[model samples]
Target: MLRESHKDRIQEEIGNDEIVTGKGLNQEISLVRAEDTRWNSHLKTITSLISLFPEVKKVLEYVEDDGDNGASRLQASGLLSYFKTFEFVFYMHLMLTILGLTNSLSQALQRKDQDILEAVDLIRTTKAQLQMLRENGFDQVLEKCYSFCDKHEIVKLDMTEALNPCNSFSQFNKSSLLKLSKMYPRDFDDKERMILEHELDIYYHFVYNDVRFANLNGIADLARSMVATRKHLSYPLVYRLLKLTLVLPVATATVERCFSAMKLVKTNLRNRIGDDFLNAALICDIEKEAHAKVKTEDVIDRFQKMKTRRGQI
Candidate 1:
């Protein structure tokens, strides 16, 4: 009832030219609810909130003054008050910036194509952008926040206030490498495990000093570069580890894709699908690229070869 009222009010506002359309805002725009399962949903919610700020305030004000129940009026009043706070505005801009940076990478990871090299490249780019933002983006964010607060008539923070900076970075250590190696025990022998740390040290220094390895697009490029320069032979353990790292993302995406495929394969109409058939269907659905390559004639030939029929059709 409340949402319908709000929707009607928004339409009225639009008709009165109180809420301007264009620049991604339209009559169809509404408050998007964030889902806990998906990070991108929060992005959508924030974007909608920002775009519909004025209309939202108007709706809230109307509800606060003319709500049917005291509780609804009180809730609307509280939200209006909270919306005007400097902290809320500041965090909204901050999250918008952070999530905007990572949104592409998140989407890329979940793609059906699932390019491992491209995903790795995006991860690197996101990390680099985040590090750069950490070092230099505070003043920019602060300026935007101040601008937004001023535009919305919200109370702004003092520019004279000094803020402490936080900084941290992670490096792969021998212990961490050993732990990772233990997870793939079959991939590493006792000798390889013992010498892995040494290979890593040499590989790190070599790559750091070598211009050829610097600014490589992704792990795939790095692997190819190492092979091109015959450095993979020099650092076999590190190359193995790199190969292992590349496979992990694809494996995770495959599992996610399988679960997604299950919804399409075993719908309400096909709810009686057995486990065996469902599994086979999921495999075919998830690996559509591979499945598409198999010719119908080849399948027919293989099926015919599987059994000797009493009567040939």
Candidate 2:
């Protein structure tokens, strides 16, 4: 129901005295529709909804009371009732707060710079923020919800009981550490695995207490700190584990990119290509940076040297 005329009516109802001719509503705010593929779209939609709430209610009330179409009137009535409920308002504010917290991290990950270290640091920061919110943010959010309900004349539910937030952060326990070590059997034999267990116990305590490593943001930073302090020699197995963790994201992204490149390489027109040629094409396509560095003349000379030719160029 939020057409140009409807927006004009909303503006007039809200006492916005701006005058403009020929469909020029200078202060009109429109609702945003969310998309499935883009998560930030949901955040934008929520923000717009919150901003245009009074305008939306005015439009819906007009439609429900005096609209020309019966179906439109029924829809507007149902929506108006739903929008005034405590549950809807409460969840809307909750989602707004949560999405706002992670929006920066989401934008960082989508950047084209491929700075894995920064991305990892953002991941850690996001996790810590979420944990803190879970532990201590409920009362603050509830107070906001209460103020909103009071302003809007919505009924407030009694929130007398409080829930104990469960701790979800992963702890480096013995079993978990052993499971991680077993993933790379070649890197750690039986003797080294036992040593790694001991090293982990010491490493966790040391890092937590050490001033230099206290503020390290990412695994890469921790690795560098270990080397700079010559602690890598002190805990060789733990240092090795840090190195593995550092490359895990890069390795995962490379594998994902290779699979994505396959879709472009093995099209319907090229479906008949052999496995050997397909593999070579995918490798070149995925590693374009490395492929671009080689000289064309060198590739041509290498191809020519593979077999005797009747004519040489």
Candidate 3:
């Protein structure tokens, strides 16, 4: 509903006299769709919502009062109530903060030249930042939320009151913590430390220290360098492991795109297409650059040569 309202406003602005000629001030932007499996898309959607808050609020107000149906009015009222709160603002900022790092990491991991070594370093950096945020970001977020609420004239929640659990059952007693820890040995202490130490040992001595792996910057480079240097033959097991890692596809945006395309291509009307044909079609769809390089004349010639067919001038 908020996006729909913004769309109307954007269209109005685009049709307006003054702002239409401006480059940056124009209303060409649209809200991104947030897919549940794609965190970056969600981040983008949230970011867009934050940018269009005033317009969104106006739209919500209109819907709350002027909706055609009771259900819509109720839904809009609920959404407006939820949106105009310190908790929602704080959570929005918090998710945007966290997803920024994760989005970068996701993009980096999906790069064609992505290195496992570099990915490990990026993961460690992100983990450290998360730890810092966990320790100190709550108060900072609350302060920002307070300022936002003040600016928007929303009822500001008392921090102390907000911190209290709504129900006694929802609050964990001091004794419950002790009991939970006693019940679960896995939650006891220093397990994470031990795991980190062991992982660091493997990475430092095995993955990073090797001269072959150290020479190249990316996984693709590593593969090529290993082949050129004949290090694969020298360290067969390590090379095989590295090769496996390089070949192993990370189910990131590429896989999501493939599935999205598959849904369109394999609709009920086109269900008769064989798996092999579907695979070929998908390859052509996904690798459009490669597909575009093939000459149509060459394809026709090949088809003609495949069997004796109807006469062609």
| Residue lDDT tens for model 3, 145-176 | 77777867876554322112223212313232
Residue-level lDDT of model 1, residues 67-113, one tens digit each, is 99999999999999989877678669878888888789878876899
- By TM-score, how accurate is candidate 2? 0.45
lDDT of 1: 0.73
Candidate 3 at residue 226, lDDT? 61
- Backbone clash total for model 1 is 0
By TM-score rank, best first, the candidates go 1, 2, 3
Per-candidate TM vs. native? Answer: 0.45, 0.45, 0.45
lDDT of 2 by residue, 281-301 (tens): 998998899999999999989
Off by over 4 Å in 1: 1-28, 159-313
Clashing pairs in 3: none
Compared to the true structure, candidate 3 yields what TM-score?
Answer: 0.45
Give the whole-model CA lDDT for all candidates, comma-separated: 0.73, 0.71, 0.63
Residue 165 lDDT in candidate 1: 10
Which model, 1 or 3, shows the larger TM-score? 1
- Specify the poorest-scoring 10-residue window by lDDT in model 2: 160-169
